[model samples]
Target chain A: MRELAKMVIVLTVLSSLSGGLLAMLREKTQDRIEQQVLEFVKGPAIRKILAGAANDPIADRFTLADGEAKRSFFVGKYDGKPDVVAFETFAGGYGGDVGLIVAVAVDTDQIVGVGVTTHNETPGVGAAVETDVGFIRQFTGLDIASGPKVTKDGGSINAISGATITSRAVCAAVGKAGDLYKRLKPEILKQLKTFSG
Target chain B: MAKTVTQEFVKGLWAEIPPFRLVLGLCPTLAVTKTVEDGIGMGVATGFVLVCSNLLISMLRNVIPSKVRIACYIIVVATFVTVVELLMQAFTYPLYLSLGIFIPLIVVNCIVLGRAEAFASKNKILPSIADGLGIGIGYTLSLAALGAVREVFGSGTFLGNPVFGPSFQPFTFMVQAPGAFVCLGLMLCLMNLAGKK
Candidate 1:
């Protein structure tokens, strides 16, 4: 009976101490961890798509209900007006769902730029889109509402010679982004006002 | 009680080095040794947990009941591992991504529990600390050595830099899982041969 009681008391004390220590650490690191994730995982692509923005798009961000799921959107200011927004969209690729960030001009309804943020496509073939500057460049200044597509699909954008599926996936992702933008434009504009100052 | 602090510490470095002499905690040793950076990061993380947990366990040795000591050790070790994980996510996000699930797995690492049960519970505070440091650093060094061997041969690069020349063809096999098994086996063989002398 003495041993059992001792065991219970010791275990309880140790567990509580451990919990307290971990809780303190978690609180201390929560904000910084969120910041680091933003800076590393999504920063490069946001910076590239919102190139030459007057403000840091990665820093100037907002999330809104796009249905049941809340999706984040990055804001880009050009000449001091936040008129372009970037958000991620996905479509099936050769290996998995390809994540593409499509930046659209709110005022002109044209694509500011597009960048491939994540993908699992074949290297040197489908995955080439990551650094295939010319391929992604084709989407710049294109009308977002037209639903971007490849030349083979009766669209002007030329697909990479060997990665038709990945090219189609990118185009489909951009189209999805177009639809998302149209759905969230009102909430996004309202959110952008908070950053306008 | 008879062993000095220095003796306890030094013994961990070579005589009972976690991976080679004791032949334990092979999970992270094989998985993260693909790069010197990863190896060092994992080593340092594990070392921090080992030292901290050992110190705590040693301090609480008398208070903890023998029946619940393992439970107490786990709580202590888990708290430190979580602290390391959160801190890593906050400051070293890239390394955190590379190490991934292995950081949490440190809870089950026999080295920590083994030391707590076998050495720390029976030792003084100073000796426990020394033992933890020695073993932690030993683990780090072993990981770094294995990582060097694999990275140089597999990727033809050291810590992301080209080691030989651009012309040197990478032995792709050394970077995969099977290569990890072979590399670890060879290292164990070498350690055994050296010990025989």
Candidate 2:
């Protein structure tokens, strides 16, 4: 009984100490982490797409809304014109989830750009999403008219060689994003116009 | 005490390698080893977490109750993981973003948990720390080797720089998921062969 009591006391003290240390660490870094996440999500990719725009990037101005399943995003304005709105989709990839960021030009109803925010696709092959600038750049001006197919299917964009599954996954995600944009464009534009006025 | 500490540290490298020999922490081992840099980053992060957690757990081994040991270990491990994650975010944002969910997932990595339960729970603090370092280094070395194989064949690059020059035709398939398995399997086979010799 004495041994057991001693054990219990030691365990309790250790747990408490460790917990307190963790709490202190979390408090110290929580704000910095939040800032880092914000910068990462909105940094280079958003800037790349919104290059030369009179207004700030949509990621900077917009608020993200969580729906039942999907995420909806609204960007404020560009040069007094509501130019972009985005929607994020989570797609299953070869290794894990892929987060696709699709930004649309509200006025044109065309894709402004598409960025892969997160992916666990194979490193050199499926992960070409990040490494292959040309492949991603193809999405810049594409829209419903492009029909989102690989070069093998006579489309303009070339798929990453030897990573058909991952390439197809990205293609499908972009296609879906385009479809969603088409469906949501009218309402999004209406909201933008009201807000701008 | 000195002999025991030496044993604890040395054992992790060969007798009980975290991934190759012991087959612990396979998830992160396979998931983040696409690039040499990522592999090294993950290895270091995991090592830091492992060593700290092992020391703390060892110090508290006498006190934690048997019935709730697992829960207490998890909480302790998670706290360290969170600290590591935040540090990476602040100091190595690009690498942190590249690692993504795998960082948080480290909290559940079997190697850390396994040590906490099997060894640290019954060991002295110094020996546990040595064990953690040895195991962590073994795991890191394995990841670096895997990353080197994938990066060289798949992209003709070593650590993000083109090694074979532009003229070399890279084997794109080597960086895919299948390649991870193939590389690991072949490595295991080689290790077994060396042992036989």
Candidate 3:
């Protein structure tokens, strides 16, 4: 019993020390990390999707509460008005979750663009969701109420060659984003005023 | 005694080159080496975890109880792996996204645990550090070589840029899952041939 107690104590101390050190490191790197993620990972997709916006959408971003989760929205300005809001959605894909950044023009209620932020679909097959711009362009000007779907499912959006599952995943992600936009339209419109050009 | 430290470091580069020589940590070796960028990123991250864990494990070698030592090593290694994961997510977000689940998977990498059990737990701090650096760098180089070969043949590109010009058709077989195994197998054969020489 005494030897067991000693062993437990040693393990506990080691664990505690490790935890404390990790906590300190995390606290120090938290902000820099958040900045880096925004700049490198999601920056390109947001920029591409909101190409014509005058304001830097990534910088002019805010988070909104939707039930238990907080979702981030990037505001893009056109003609000095914050008229577009871009947000991310994750949907089930062939290999894993496919992340899509969907941007909507507040005044038009039409999709500005859609871009794949993250995906694990097979390269040269399902991964075409990220590489094929023509497919992605089909999302532009889509009305939020219509809810986009791939052509195989009786919708207008055409699935990529040999990548029907990934194409469906992209549609699913956009569909989720459209739902979120509809549910949070009032909140999103109210918050848009804060992001002035 | 004078050259022992140098020997330890040099052995990792050639005689004990991981995946190729030691044949440990093959998961990351295969999964992330699809691109040179990913291969180097994964290698460097693994090296950081290895070096830090080795140093800590060696420093606490005498203090940790034998029964709970493996558990203790895991905690220390996990702490470092988390740190790397956070840092990578922040600064190298693209690489982080590409590497995906493999980043968290580093925690279970046998190389990290193997070194702690075989070397760090028995050696002094300096030798352990040397061992870690050598092994980590060797792993990095091996991954890079594999990544280069795969990328060049599979995509006809080097580091995502067209290396073979437009006329060169890519041999797509080298980039898929089957390609990783075939490439690794052929690499092992080459290493064996070289070792005999």
Candidate with top TM-score is 1
lDDT of 1 at B10: 93
Ranking by DockQ: 1, 3, 2
Instruction: Summarize candidate 1's per-residue lDDT along B1-197 as a digit string, tens digits.
Output: 49888998999899999788988898888899999999999999999999998999899989998877787888899899999999999999999999999999999988888888898898889999999999999999999988999999999989999989879999988988889889989988988898895
- On TM-score, the stronger of 2 and 3 is 3
TM-score of 1: 0.88
The lDDT per prediction is 0.90, 0.78, 0.90
How does each model score on TM-score?
Answer: 0.88, 0.64, 0.86
Q: Report the interface RMSD that candidate 2 achieves against the true structure, in angstroms.
A: 3.1
Q: If you assessed candidate 3 against the hidden native complex, which CAPRI class would it receive?
A: medium
The TM-score measured for candidate 3 stands at 0.86
Q: Could you give the CAPRI-style class of model 2? A: acceptable
For candidate 2 chain B, the 10 contiguous residues with the lowest summed lDDT are B1-10
* Candidate 2 chain A lDDT trough over 10 residues, lowest sum: A58-67
lDDT of 1 at A116: 85
* Interface RMSD, in order shown: 0.8, 3.1, 1.5
Give the alpha carbon lDDT tens digit for every residue of B75-161 in model 3. 988889998988887677778879989988988999999999999999989989999999999999999999999999999888889
Question: After superposition, which runs of candidate 2 have C-alpha atoms over 4 Å from their true positions?
Answer: A1-23, A49-197
- Point out the worst 10-residue segment of candidate 1 chain B by lDDT: B65-74
**Candidate closer to the true structure by DockQ (higher is better), 1 or 3:** 1
